[model samples]
Target: MALAYFVLGDADRGRANLRDYYLAIGPDHADQIARSAGTHTVALKETIESFAAIGADELILLPGLDDVNEVDRLAEAVL
Candidate 1:
């Protein structure tokens, strides 16, 4: 399992496997799975303040953020 692999300290491989699996199943299935799990799935295309206003407790920059200064500022503001 992906989570099992992650917990076993192979996060890169685990995440890759999970991503591949998700892609294979496609968005509709992924959305269904997310709904069944009681999660509100969303794309991270909005500003940090907007996300915060929508009750986001934490933010993960990932591919959307690259500026170190901005990242630090957001981290400080959020955390």
Candidate 2:
């Protein structure tokens, strides 16, 4: 599974988005899936590094909120 609803600096926003996502999808394994999301920059970076260590060829990051600035924020944090 890919990391979804990630916020570069705002952990609270990321978590809120995850909650909303869970409510919308109503998945049976919401708790498990929540672990896949990155709630802050450190968590996101760790997730990326872990994937790389496992020889992952690509990783997808889904935005936590509808903000175009998120792109720049991610770039600033991870790029």
Candidate 3:
């Protein structure tokens, strides 16, 4: 997404704001965050489908990307 922004002459930074957005809230909170993220993905997919059904013309997605292996797994899973 940031790369595409760069390609389109917009100087948006993705990786540059990581520390500002993420926090080390410890292991217990980690599991909750993980579970919430998973649930949110399901909700988002349904919402997007519903919007599409109602004639939504534009949808932009910044996927839930974490680890390097996860990215590769998702790429293989979908692409």
Candidate 4:
């Protein structure tokens, strides 16, 4: 499975959430899962491109929180 976190400007928020998620899931594969998150627009875009390069048919962006600004942030960065 693939997972990501896209934040407007507060990368720390995303990292913190990722950390919580990591802890909740246990630390056995933390290294791999931690690297899978994208905390900002540029990183998100890069991740999308990287996946596309590898022939990904679709991409899904899951929210880390309930903030609506994330939609605008993502559009500004990727759309």
Model 1, runs deviating above 4 Å: 1-22, 27-45, 64-79
Candidate 2 lDDT tens digits, 1-79:
4444466546566656666668666655554465566766787788898888887868888776677888888877787
Q: What does candidate 4's lDDT look like per residue over 1-79, in tens digits? A: 3445565656567656666777766765554455566766778889898878888767887765567887877888888
Compute the lDDT for candidate 1: 0.36
Over the full model, what C-alpha lDDT does candidate 3 score relative to the true structure?
A: 0.36
Candidate 3, 45: how far from true, in Å? 3.1
Candidate 2, which segments miss by more than 4 Å at Cα? 1-4, 24-28
Tens digit of per-residue lDDT, candidate 3, span 7-57: 111112222223223437655554343333322334545545665777776
Worst 10 residues of 4 by lDDT: 1-10
Residue 41, model 1: Cα distance from true site in angstroms: 22
User: What's the lDDT for candidate 4?
Assistant: 0.69
TM-score quality measure for candidate 3: 0.28
Off by over 4 Å in 4: 28-35
RMSD of 4: 2.5
Clashing residue pairs in candidate 3 (N, C-alpha, C atoms within 3 angstroms)? none
In candidate 2, what residue range of length 10 has the lowest lDDT sum? Answer: 1-10
What is the C-alpha local distance difference test score of each model?
0.36, 0.69, 0.36, 0.69
